[model samples]
Target: MLWEVDQKVKEAADALHPSSNVDHMQNILQDTLIHCWELLLKRHSATMQIDAKFQDLLFRALDYYVVGRLHEMLWWLVCERCQVVDQLVKTRLSHLRHAHLSALQLGVPAHYYTPLPAAVVELASLASVESAIGRLQCVHSTIELIQAQAKEARVTLHQYKDQEGEPELELTKEELMALLTTVVVQAQCSHLVANIYYMTHYVFSVTEDDPLWKSLGLLRNTLENIMKLDVARLPQPAKSIRKELSLQDLMQVSAEVESRFEAKGPSRSIGDITALDLQLHQLTQQIQLSTQAHSETHLTERNSPSRRSDRTMLSPTQDNSKSHSFREFLSSIPSSLRESLRRRQSQQRSAIQSSLNG
Candidate 1:
């Protein structure tokens, strides 16, 4: 049914040319295509798997349709049909394929299985899926390149727009699209492919005393440092706004900015914003060190006791001395309730002294 309808639509389209009577021919072709789509949906609804496969087919097929606009159209269609799946599957199918097997074995669907680590199997499943997103760094680089190119092109075309004579041929929408597509493809090829390999090694290249794994472990502490620096260096938005505003507007501006002020009221300084960025870079180094330490600590915890005891047993005198020392340390400590009360009293005294000094 679909094939016959598609044939009719094609025949109608073939009968028309750019210079021919397009209006009548387009109406006929549109009717044929709409009818074919309706029949296709009817056949799709008749089977459970057919409906699923049709969704997949449309999802993949539309990528080649009208330079990627149809993919969004297919998305709306799937949404209307309530066919949304896991976001990991939808957004990061490539990364999801590389995710731990635990993710794959999650749902109790009939087709689900103990996943094997075969890129081929994952690729087969994803053959009908959209292309994976390019890396962020790639997009960043591409934007920089495009801006640079645009600036250079603008410089070259500066005289063309000023001419008062005949109009120059403007770049067609298709031509501009083709140029942007080239840039996107180049960005994906250059950065995303390289970064994927690097990221894969970072995640999976575990070994004895692996430096890469160590670096990843320390990242959170580095982030903490970054946050501290960022808090300190953040621009005093209110002060800058105040400086730029007239006395008349300052009153209204204060009212507008009041809601965003911190507990201490708006900042009256712009000491340094770059320090935050610098600290972030320093944090990366700290993160690397921390990661190494954590991995080393974990490795020690896993293997330390066995190695420590593998040596000659301690002498009875040494063992007794160690045991005695531990008991003495425990006994020297005050009770938890007493310790808490003592610390609270010390804090209260310090607060009172500070208040007196102030």
Candidate 2:
């Protein structure tokens, strides 16, 4: 099953024109994956009586494998231009980081920017990796940390509500936005847009209910809002501070970090999924275990009143125009195709639950 899917995905990828639009390539990738998935289901259903759980696990492993392989192919196909874009991303992030640190030193409250610098650093680290899966994981982890911080801030606000002498400790929505602005500005990610695009169109297939997908959407909204912010309105660092944080120092630090990452070796790369010794069954088991653990944790959180409230507080107000545009995109998709894709994803989730019990 894995071999067949790989062959089909490779053939589709190889057929793409070198100059094809990224959006067009994304569509082709999705259509190809769906085709392969449907074919696998039909071919296997007749020969063997595999449970839906195993079937879903098989699909997930296949999805991971295909996406990882495509990441490698895309490096040569589209990411050659990404090298130039990455340099620009790095430069922008450097400026933002310097500004953030300067803001801290220049009397801006440290609490206002506490967790955001860590978030930026985490994302900047992800810039070194070219894998879509790697980037997705990094974004997911960063969002989780931020979400926890936001929850803590909310708790602190409630605890100090009646206290007379308490400091202004609550992280308000405006403060959150300001801090997020800093993060969006400083996320030094190479192929950032492409990674988001790839994950949305291919991996999650725009499953809005998925937590990771929702987190990515929130980040996308934050990135879009950057243009609306008045750059001059933001606090300016002292000339001395700006001079102290030289691009040379930034480059040296980045080089040391990259060296550390490299020393850990290619085992961290998504390409490890395609290793000859890693059997499909083993991959399926790993994904199944992970899915089960995640589902259990999600259920526990959903049932917690405090967790529910925290989620409500943490959810950002999305841009209405952007929401409408997304709705329009969904409506533009042929009803039949949308139904097919939705049905497939639903099956994948349901199958995971059913298999875990068995």
Top lDDT prediction, candidate number:
2
TM-score of every prediction relative to native: 0.19, 0.51
Per-residue lDDT, model 1, residue 270, is 26
Candidate 1 to truth, TM: 0.19
Q: Which ten residues in a row have the lowest lDDT in candidate 2?
A: 271-280
lDDT of 1 at 343: 53
* RMSD to true structure for each model, in Å: 34.0, 19.0
Q: On residues 228-301, what C-alpha lDDT tens digit does candidate 2 reach at each position?
A: 33334555543332223244454454454445545655444332121111222243456557767887554222
The lDDT of model 1 is 0.31
Residue-wise C-alpha lDDT for candidate 1, range 1-358, written one tens digit per residue: 6457546645654654544432343244334433444444445434532454553344223212211222233233323322222221122222211221121122211111111123222222322332211122223333344334433433333332343454323433333232333232222221221222222211111222443333222221221221122112233222221113343453354443333333324442322222222223344456557767887554222222222342222211223453344334333322122333335434543453343344
- The list of candidate 2 runs beyond 4 A from truth reads 21-24, 35-58, 75-91, 101-113, 116-118, 128-134, 150-175, 204-206, 235-358
Candidate 2 clash figure, as a count:
0
